[model samples]
Target: MSRLDITHERASYQAVFALDVITAAGALIFLGLASKPTFQRIKQRRFTAPNSKNNSARDGPLKTTLGTYLFLWPALLCLFIAYVCRLVSDLLKTAGTINYDDDLGWNGRRAYSTADSGYASNISALTFTTALATIFFTVLLNGGVWIHSSHVQENGTGISTPRTKSRIWNSAIMLAMLGTGLAAWGLGIHARDVSTGSSGPHALLSWSTVLQHHRATRIMYIVHEAIVVAASLSVSIEVLREYATTNRNARDSPERKDLLRFAFAVVPLIWLRDIFILYDVVLLYVDTAGWSATAVDATTLLLVVCRQLANLAILGMVLWGAWRMSRSVALFGRSYYA
Candidate 1:
């Protein structure tokens, strides 16, 4: 590598490392904030009688929404894992624990070289975690909101029925499961890439590579993203429909509305990340040959920043929305309620 190339490569790695550190910290903060209400609710449930009159008025309707709060945690956890994997990948690569092969580079002396084995496996793990977080976070957030709104609506009318499990909710659930399965299957296919050796740059840490250079890996991610997009679109429509149909004068209407609005905010962020992923795949195929080291480095850092920040924003919204839902007027028996 020339002097300029060396400088660019070092700068790129440092920037990514710093980004991972910051993003991980943010994810931890969000996780802690989001879990506060969940833990408090758990404690309250332990101490209070489920049938007690005092608890009944406060907990009755909101208990139905507990699943919403609970569901948010797993998504947050998945995100945390995803970022942690990125951090670890960067650490190992920098530490020389993971071997990078130069011959696999499309651009001579690229920053993200193809890893031989262990590094490739780390990349696969990162993809798996990212896939899980991306697929399920959108699903759970919207699904929880849908289910909570359904219960709130049913409760308002004093009629609880199986119809609360509406077709839209069912479809969302099915799609989410299918997306997750595809992601796992993709990860499995990626294992083949890992063991046989990576064919292209392993920018999994930068969110700039998703096995796209490999035919099977490319198809896997495209299909997975499509499935997630479908699920998110359906749930978003349902949530919007509920928002319109919900009576403004109803007691829980504002809570439902606020939650739906949060969902609206999050879905677009998900799509934005999806778009970033697409750009990365395109970059790989178009060939980064003749691209300057600085250009490659800058591109990697840009994608990392955009994708991680989007994830942080999504987690923050979930924290706020879950906190609001848990502390709503209809739900009581927690310290906040007291």
Candidate 2:
């Protein structure tokens, strides 16, 4: 190749490589930040007692809020980093005059490269997935906050009322899940067209052709994402209801038991959906070995099958946990009410 060609290739390669490195670094930072407070809280056994009546008096306002916020710092950092990376990538593309057909210059040419295309698509999927995941995760975290706040308020004010705060939070979570699910469905339709025999680029190129192609794999991914979202929403709702009513008195008190049992039951379903997502990513991104083709696929079909079994195991564990919790709740109710 000529010197010009070599220079172009080198520059394009470097930009793509940098993008990947920065993205990975951001993810690691997020993971580290998220885990720090969790580790500390675990060591402290913060959940040992129900929210104390004098929590504010004992811990003070700043200490309580700071501790709670610290756990969420990592997630916030991840969101910030993701937004920055996306903005930077867009800027570079625009400045480099990157074109779908290499119109502008180095930036355009680099953006159109095969590696760049796959990278961009994968990042898009990951970003959307992470956004959806974060919504549900944050809601759960916030639900915990509401639980603590309700407990503290009741203690301080000498007012005890059935806590419907978590219910409101869970309802919001379900709505968010529904919105994300719809988005995922739309993306899935677009992906289906791309995987099939569509002549045009994916939706990033032209939104109109998004649903042109249809593929089973793409459909499967959309379904999987939807299932995970729904399952997560269900788990959150059940947990919230249980937390709200744990202090209530009932003849059988099956409500709390049922809620706990439902949560345990859904965990495996969520796990299964996660496995399918991993499989879909591997199949969609990685090259596979064939009679004449090179590059071995990193993920195996056997591994995917094993993931299904693993999901089943998770489900079994959840069911067992639910049973145990139910039995314990029943015994407690009988002893207390009898």
Candidate 3:
């Protein structure tokens, strides 16, 4: 390759790498904030007492508190920033106007040629998909808050109720389903491009031209996502049941146990989703020669995998808390109510 070609390649590589780094850092920051004690306190405030007539015990500790908003706002801010940055990057790529190759070509060749097809259209679709997924996650987070608040109101001050446990289970299931669906849709779009020879945005539309090329693969991707969602939801339900039983007896219970067992049990299932995600990452990298080599497949699968892992860890923590609840409920039994 000529000097101009070398320079162009290096610039492209750098841009892709920068995007990856930013995405990873944003994800880690979000996860760290989510796991803080303030978040835990907010979640704990949802538990309700069984018999208190005043219902004051069931009222969330942070419902109107500034501290609660402080604890939650940072994560949302980080997510918003990350999403906006990603959208900007995608827009830049689709415009095909940024001259990635700065060095003058030996023969005045364009640094990167624009695709014959309208690049912006394909990118718009991808952006829309991502935005939709983000909305789903936001809804899930809000649902969690609602579920926690309801738990506090129903149980009174000292009594732990089973209904709260059910809500947690349902929330986890919904989140898992949403994540799984997004992953599957992404993979389906990826596979459709690979089957056709067209490059860039045009290749994405290739799916419309050849509907049967990779139909089986697309179906499999959808099924895998569904299974992941189902398994995660099942695990969440089990953990909630254990939590309700444990919390109800904590004061009178003598046996102190860790709920980590339930957490560990669900790890394998949650990890399965990550494993599939990794497979997609490897396949995309190998087939497309990394994001810079292909505009249509520029997304970083690793980032998505990391987010899934963080989610699994969060679920595990909930399980651990449930275990402690189980021990308390077992020891105290009827005395917890008294």
lDDT string for model 3 (182-278, tens) is: 6545654566445243345443432222222355544544454445445444545554454455445442222113323433544444455545544
lDDT-sorted candidate list, best first: 1, 3, 2
Single out the weakest 10-residue window by summed lDDT for candidate 2.
102-111
lDDT of 3: 0.40
lDDT accuracy of residue 243 in candidate 2: 40
Compute the lDDT for candidate 2.
Answer: 0.38
Which model scores highest in TM-score? 1
For model 1, residues 136-181, the per-residue Cα lDDT tens digits are 5555555554555444444333334226467556665657556655
Best by lDDT: 1
lDDT per model vs. reference: 0.53, 0.38, 0.40
**Which scores better on lDDT, 2 or 3?**
3
Estimate the TM-score of every prediction.
0.67, 0.33, 0.32
| Stretches > 4 Å off in candidate 2 | 1-35, 48-74, 77-81, 84-148, 151-155, 158-338
Clashes of each: 0, 3, 20
